[model samples]
Target: MSERLNGIEAFVAAVEAGNFALAAQRLGLTRSAVGKSVARLEARLGTRLFHRTTRSQSLTEDGQAYYERCRRALAELDAADAALEAGRLTPSGRLRITMPEVLGRVLVAPLLLELGAQYPELSFDAAFNDRRVDLVEEGLDLAIRSGPLDDSTALAARPMGHQWMGMFASPAYLAARGRPASLEALLAQASAHRFVGYVRDSGRPPWQFRDAKGQAVAFTPSSQFDFGCNSLEIAAMAAMQGAGIARLPVWLVREALDQGRLVRVFEEPQAFGYAVHAVWPHARAMPLKTRVLIDLLVERLVPALAVR
Candidate 1:
């Protein structure tokens, strides 16, 4: 029974870590030991688990089926462990999470650090990225996403807060170019003004706004002076430097607005914005650590983002 358990642990670790060496590192076991344990398990099961190459290992069909069952079984065991830990009221274990780079660095990281200081037993492995990731495939424990989430039974989501899109410019730029009184006026003189556009996989995105009737609209400005940036921080910086007007989330530029570095181009509030969510894989029992973090995020982040 002990040997069987060891083999199962090795196999699961290898899959999650993406290689034997890394799995060994994670498990604090020698690489050769991990490989041998998996080999023994395969020999007993009478089927090949991995299609191995010198550089990489991919799961075989049978391996994929086995892994799914094993993962669920392990989750059940983890739930049992978490239940016991809940009584102690202390969360221990590493949480693997992901979030957008700027949001993670500016907001989430500080919150997590505070949590860590409060709970000495807790640890974290975080990935700050902009691209969407599959939580299960990536073995992530949680994700903080901004914008709409696709419907999925495999995961659960909680709304953290929302961010409003606002058009902003530096005082110098606004003084020189003059502010457009309305969205229509801005569109009419789109060529006369420059824009700092946000770029993604689909290229630069159009600035989002809402019509008087509360209908969504997009404005794609055209100007040789306009430039594209992949980072929101950079776009905000460019706007501060008087390069061009930028469409940015209100929370991101709140400090600049307060410091008189950036001014709102339009006084009317725009209804166009996106909801933020705290997402995690669905489980029979939620880990105490995950629950604690989620609660903290709601307590701290919601209020911060809620303020206009």
Candidate 2:
């Protein structure tokens, strides 16, 4: 266990320093020792973490994946030690955060409000928007992201939870254009029904489903509406207005579902190949306030977004 921990510590130090020599300086070891430790870790995992030659070095695919997890884990460990040493009950800091508009307002804001009451010294500078701001450029401290973080090399993220996308429409719309009894029916009469497109960084995401065996299938919405949106609540509103069928998070439409304003089609849970994450810049070690907030978010978000 100590050996593995040493290897991980060496690996993270090297990655953060962007080279073994600087990592050696930071870790108080020889460059050769740091390199050897990383190599040992790679051999144990049976996967190469880096591609290094005399002139160039870069993280391998496996390395990139592992590095993200390791960096966050190390930050949490460092933060726990700092918090214990600080020996303070009330956290005091101004946290700058960003999140999607609807989620920020509907789900996250309430939690923050409750947390504020817990630690009155803690304050927030938040931006609720669909636009993905550069956290570093904006000097943001934390962000709750709901999709792939392909461009997150400078960020350390922890999976908080995920929301399921299910097909739903206003009761009136379903009544007018008979309910899609199954996935096949939904696709077959494609021209008869319109769909609200979900715009993402990769472009408009298609409806995703899982077969009986739980293999994923992506179905592009052929018939469309006048609007495409990035906001869950807005897309749901379009469906509620009978503009089209929307594939949206169930939480956004739970009230509508209960009130019979909307009805879910095809009794199954589906995904758009993504999950939610709470992220902060990699350069900063987690502070006591940030750590507590992340803990609260994970504790609350998972159950709130759980598929029923």
Count of backbone clashes, every candidate in sequence: 0, 0
lDDT, candidates in the order shown: 0.84, 0.79
Model 2 per-residue lDDT tens digits across residues 1-308: 65676688889998889899998666645577778889889999999999999976889999999999998987898887777757867778899999988878898999899889999999998888877778878889989888766433345677777776788988888889889887888889878887886786657766778876788888887644456877777888888898878888877788899998889876764353357888786533467678888888888877788754
- Residue 299, candidate 1: alpha-carbon lDDT: 91
Per-residue lDDT for 1-308 in model 1, tens only? Answer: 65676788789989999999998666645687779889999999999999999989999999999999999888888778777776876888999999999888898999999999999999999999888899988889999999877644356678888877788999999899989877888888887788886788667666778887888888878733276778899999999999998888888999999999999898544567788989897554678889899999999988878755
Best by lDDT: 1
- Report lDDT (Cα) of residue 92, candidate 1: 85
Which residues of candidate 2, in runs, are more than 4 Å off?
1-87, 151-154, 200-203, 226-230, 269-273, 283-285
Q: Candidate 2 has which clashing residue pairs, if any?
A: none
TM-scores, in order shown? 0.72, 0.70
Residue 93 miss distance in model 1 (angstroms): 0.3
What's the C-alpha lDDT at position 305 in model 2? 81
